[model samples]
Target: MSEQSKSPQAPDRTPRVVIAGAGMAGVQTAVALREQGWRGAITLLGDEPHQPYDRPPLSKAVLLGKADGATLDVDFPGLGIDLRLGCRATALRPADRLVETDQGPVRYDYAVLATGAAPVRLPGTEGLSGVHLLRTLDDAERLRPELAGRRRIVVVGAGWIGAEFATAAREAGCEVTVVEAADRPLAGALPPEVARYMAGWYGDAGAELRTGVAVASVAPGAVTLADGTVLPADTVVVGIGARPATAWLAGSGVALSPVDGSVLADERLHTSVPGVYAVGDCASFPSARYGTRLLVHHWDNALQGPRAVAENIARGEAEGVVYDPVPYFWSEQFGRFVQYAGYHGDADELVWRGDPAGAAWSVLWLRRADGPDAVAGAGRLVALLAVGRPRDLAQGRRLIERGALLDRERAADATVPLKAAVR
Candidate 1:
């Protein structure tokens, strides 16, 4: 037997494993542990009083009253995990491997830093009564009433939340305006051409798109721009960005990425410190596909990372499965169902598979001019961006990976279905 197999298994003794931040990431960790046949006692620490819930529907269905907060309740009882809700994790001491919470200090045999992230609020816009951010159930609940009447809503960022909130505001019969510092929407993720197509979406949906504008300050019923233009608004929803909630790990001997405040984890999701693993939005791991340390904050990543960590923690290693996903995210905004799978960083060419002027459309991003036949990374198809046709995304993803040469003329022709062009 290998030395690892011969080593005596760690005494179970109902090993107490403590997880902080009871969002999707935290709850998924506990559930994944049980699924991995881990017999350790699991305790979840969260700042919210409610049980673990899904967060994506908050700005969309929840705000529309079609969905309620309770609908997001995760079945933790079914997984045999003790949930310590309504409490915040204050600190972590690696020297003693303990987590300090508002209730008391919980000694941990293994610690999972799934603290997730905090919504970045635009500075100089604080203390405003009507300003809101969607990070927790409380934030969503507090802003729920503001969407009732015909209110003037100003979304401070043109990213996912801003676009989604703008959509919701327009649905609520409110006038909406989106402010983005970049030239177009989703600039950080999507290419310029793709973003321009999305920019037209806000206008078509009756929401103003104030691109290349920066917020100077915010006051009651108005957002002042850098150019001194005051946009009137009854509610200001800030979705500028988010920073990883790693303040508690400041001196905890864990390596954290200084760029976005994300934790640095190896292929096993193990941190530099032994027995300390980080996952979800708090972790930046090297991706074999992207060839970079990717920090994906989507729901799928959190749901997948814990299983890898649990198996590794229990048996010292987990092969065949790691936390590298293709990176997919979907947003429902302005009556447009937007979905993008795969990353398209610095793509040189973009081909529209459908009509951008129409409600349902999709775009294929390529790194070079040749074709989707081009290999990914150096010069290949990297992302499938679809606004309405969700099925096209799946087909496009498959063709792009196999380096299939697409008929440039008919491939992007809206009249032809993507699958039909495959052969």
Candidate 2:
């Protein structure tokens, strides 16, 4: 072993890897290391008492009691992994190779940070009886009763989580009122032209949507708007946004992004500290594919980032793979399947495959061939948003990965397959 990562123990002691946050990223990293032939001590830590479970279903099936919980189907005992539930990593000491936790301090040769993210609660809503945030399984369990009672719900944000919660609430026969500070839903995600069409969805689903307004205060039984308008809300759901849960990294000397508090990982998913890597919602990685650093908080990132981290850790540093991926994520809301892929740029051209008002349509973001940045993947497919069109998403995602150039005229034809439009 190199003098850098060598521990204080004798040379023959087995190597140990400590993983914090037992979400998909942490669990997959532990399993991937084993799969990649790392037969050493692996310790997985989680703050929650329940076994490692999925988060997406907490807003859908679990809220409606259609399923108990989205528990992952990994056999930790069979794999010889030490999985510790309800043990949260308080701080990381890279210099000593020790992770300080509530249970105790644990030493390791390598560590992975996958602490994920925490939801952004509305200001002044804390400890309010009816205020709620739907990020964890417990939060969903707390909300199931309210939905079962058919309570009037006012969702704070119009982002992805808010839309999904509204969908679930509408399905459960509860009155849902979504209020957005922006003028339209998904304002931060999509441009005004694209997101305008989604405004109709809330009304069509029998939910009330109030846009271009801010919430002034939250009471036990009502919400006061900034415009002196008061909304009667039996149960308030906050879905504004979420930030990376990296507060424990403070004073750890790990380089974190000033913009979002995400661990600034390099191309190999390695953090500023030696022998330490960050993945999933807690880290932001430099993306050569998009010429930017991206902090992706979607399930696909959690699923994909760990594999690269595992391969790099299992293999030597010289053989480490670069962690650039065409990002993808999907959501079912308002009875429409919404899928998005790749990272869109400000200068990219937008092309419509079908009418946005129609049930099935797609919007593709492409770079121009004659643009000044032609050398760096200009004229290539950069990003796409597919609504009620799975085939378009499947094909567009592959095209984005390949950096395929497309014929604009052919791409505009909704009937033509995306692959056929490739130049």
* C-alpha root-mean-square deviation, each candidate: 5.6, 3.5
User: Which tens-of-lDDT digit does each residue in 208-257 have in candidate 1?
Assistant: 89999899999988899999999998888999888899998888888988
Q: Which regions of candidate 1 are displaced past 4 Å?
A: 1-13, 70-73, 318-320, 367-380, 398-410, 413-423
Q: Give the worst 10-residue stretch by lDDT in candidate 2.
A: 1-10
TM-score between model 1 and native: 0.89
Model 1: lowest-lDDT 10 consecutive positions: 1-10
Top candidate by TM-score: 2
Query: On residues 1-423, what C-alpha lDDT tens digit does candidate 2 reach at each position?
Result: 232346546543578889999998999999999998988899998999999999999988999999989999999999989899999999999888988888777788899999999999898888989899999999999999999999999999999999999999999999999999999999888988899888999999999999999999999899999999999999999999999999999999899999999999999999999999999999999999999999999999999999999999989679979999999999999999999999997788889999999899999998876646554333689999999999999999999999999888888899999999997
Q: Each model's C-alpha lDDT?
A: 0.79, 0.92
Residue runs of model 2 more than 4 Å from their true location after superposition: 1-12, 371-378
Displacement of the residue 266 alpha carbon in candidate 2, Å: 0.5
